[model samples]
Target: MSLTQEQKDAFKAIFIETVTNFAQQVGQATEKVFLQILPLTVVAGTEYLKSYEEDLKTKLEDCKTKSQKIIGALSTVKEPEKVEKTGDKHLPLGELLGKRVQRGEDWKWDDQDGGIGSFGKVVGVKGNGWVKVQWESSRNENRYRWGVDKAYDVKVVEIVDDLGDIPPLEEQIKKPTSWVIGKSVVRGRDWKWKDQDGGEGQIGEVIDVCDEGWVEVKWKNGTVCQYRWGGENAFDLKVVPKPKE
Candidate 1:
């Protein structure tokens, strides 16, 4: 469903205000200072701005994940009707029919599966076994009728069901845990690192402060895991709580 006008307005207000604040903070004066220091930062250290970009993205994704989880939990009572799979849940008519011809629940796309070269996103569910999808007629596929049949292969695309509730402000805050031995965040960001929930490689202290990504984490098992910054593919960032709702 499209966002309600009020919701849209609220999002607009928050987004615009936050952007304005960021712009003011990073205004011309700040940019000049950054430019002057850029050479020194580059030579003496890795550009922090680049890493900070990732830091922002990580925090945003984490917020989204938390939102999804909370939405899922509160959804039972607040959004039972939302359980219906509209977009990605329902495959397109052609894709659906093609799947019927040949079957694949766990189907995967590889060098083989004829990609949805023509198939667009699934828009709505038509009647039984039929789904409406956005698609342009394929020249080689004999018009849109090429509706992926037994001929074409399948691939799954991820689509969210709907925009969940933004969540109460309190849920956005970070809670501390003392079960783990080591508590280390990214060099600059604030995601605490832990080992497998608890125990083993759980305790660590800063043996020495190194540059950028490297931090020494001692597991409870007394084993040291060395990281080269982006080593784990996932970097943690500090959590900033939104204003109380």
Candidate 2:
């Protein structure tokens, strides 16, 4: 006779409970035997007890294996039911919208070449998990779709009060002929000095400017190097105006 759904469920539950209880009782019995043998410590008593314990442990492991097999068998006894959705229903995009993000919030792209450390700002978040961000290094705005299109590629790192106060990359890299020795400057994104590894946003002072336009900069860390002052490397160095003392 075929059993009803409720009857089948009750039978399966009872079977699992019974087997689990039996396994627990066997485990407890094994532990009791080990405890009872703990007191004997004569010459050969130790060796004998150790051998018996090993044998007992092997039996317990076999029991555990059998219990696991019983549980595995239960899976074949019943098939899982699948629920079908009828309407044009969709899961809500929660926590992916403005909740965790806001305008002018700094972010870093989680990509190769250490984009994770590169700073950017959120321009806006479109409804369906799309967020527009303006990168600090490139100064370019790009749209990223969260969850679906690796929106997690970029993570919000900081929030600024005013983005407008930040100067453009072009203006920051402009070479001023009036720059004199001992003037402070910052390493721009285009700055790629070998051996020194001068990272982006590193502040330094101009130690000397050669006739060929190669400027020797003394970084805040005391490391000095002569970096090229023209082409791609030219924009790599930015002149920083000294703050009022």
Task: Please name the candidate that would achieve the greatest lDDT relative to the true structure.
Answer: 2
Residue-by-residue lDDT tens digits, candidate 1, 96-197: 321111112433433122343433333222222333233323211111211223222223354312213333323322221110012232222334545432
Q: How many residue pairs clash in each candidate?
A: 11, 1
Per-model TM against the reference: 0.16, 0.26
**lDDT tens readout by residue for model 2, 158-227:** 3333222435557544533213234456765566564363565667765544444566677767797776
lDDT (Cα, 0-100) at 158 in candidate 1: 40
Q: What does the lDDT read for residue 125 in candidate 2?
A: 45
Q: Report lDDT (Cα) of residue 90, candidate 2.
A: 16
Candidate 2: regions farther than 4 A off: 1-169, 172-177, 194-200, 231-233, 243-245
Error of 1 at 236 (Å): 53
Residue 120's lDDT in candidate 2: 50
Best by TM-score: 2
